[model samples]
Target: MTETSKNLIAEYYALHLGELRAFVAKCTGSPADSEDMVQTIFLRLLQTDKMISAVTLPCLVYSAARNIVADYWRHRKSVERHETYVKSHCDCGTDSGPASVYAPAEIMQLLERGMARLSPKSRRIYTMSVVGGMRVSEISDTLGVAYKSVENRLGAARKEMRRYMSRMLA
Candidate 1:
């Protein structure tokens, strides 16, 4: 685009920034998402090679903001649906709600079996975090392991335990 077109866009963006932000917020009903959408709108404008006419810039900005809000809601719904599907199919007893299905006796028996199956390092890391109430950083410092290693082992341990519990319960 020409310098003149750039100047026009800059001026228009500067003059109407708040209106654009408010427009997105009203469209999405979320100030946080609106802020992101506003940035995306201007970033698209600034990066594009096509020259936008001064008269048409406002319409294009509003139209793009509307499209972004629609896309955000669509993506949000898709994610929620995916989560719902996973929750319905899997009874891993990872959280308190579904985990209540197992009686205390069954939970104890399953937990012991699960812990026994994990690698020694993973089992120790899991214990340090869960039983010892230690954070990942503290565990890493005490064990002289990388922070990520401690974190990863904790995740692996949990996954292993969950799989074992699920299999036993099934």
Candidate 2:
């Protein structure tokens, strides 16, 4: 990378890290995912010579980040749609009526519907991990699965849930 680019990136990170993090978190719906996306954005910038030379470099980064976030949302939406289709095919059905959870009835209903959309195994894994507050090892033992399987399932479940929340809000 050029000295100018290094200086620019440093300046941007020093001055705008919090803002960028907040922006990415708002766009991506989670802090951890936003952190990953921001790292990816900067890495992409570092690798691209053309992008490094733009006069409006900061704006360009933000734009690119936005595009990335949009793409992420698109993929997430696709996953949710697939899950919904699978859910429809499965015996697990959603309740259109009021929910018993803490949120407003409508919001709770939507969350339940979204959770219902997940595969039965995924739903069980998620409930155990989140609601039951079980560790991966504990969940794996309880479910008679490996720790890695629990981790992978939980990761996918979290992504699906975030996507569901994003779609619900949007």
Candidate 1, residue 19: the lDDT equals 91
Per-residue CA lDDT of model 2 for 1-170, tens digit only, reads 78898888878877887888899999888998998888878877777777465467788789878988997898799879977864565443454433422246766787788889899988999999777867788899888998998899899989999799767744
Model 1 TM-score, 2 decimals: 0.53
TM-score of each: 0.53, 0.51
Residue lDDT tens for model 1, 1-170: 77887788889888998999998888778998888789888887877787689888888888888888987888789779966865576665565574546677876887877898888899899989877967798899899999998999999898887678667866
Candidate 2 ranges beyond 4 A from true positions:
51-54, 93-170
| Range of the 10 consecutive residues with the lowest summed lDDT in candidate 2 | 93-102
Q: Give the lowest summed-lDDT range of ten residues in model 1.
A: 92-101
- Cα deviation at 128, candidate 2, in Å, is 30
Which candidate has the top score in lDDT? 1
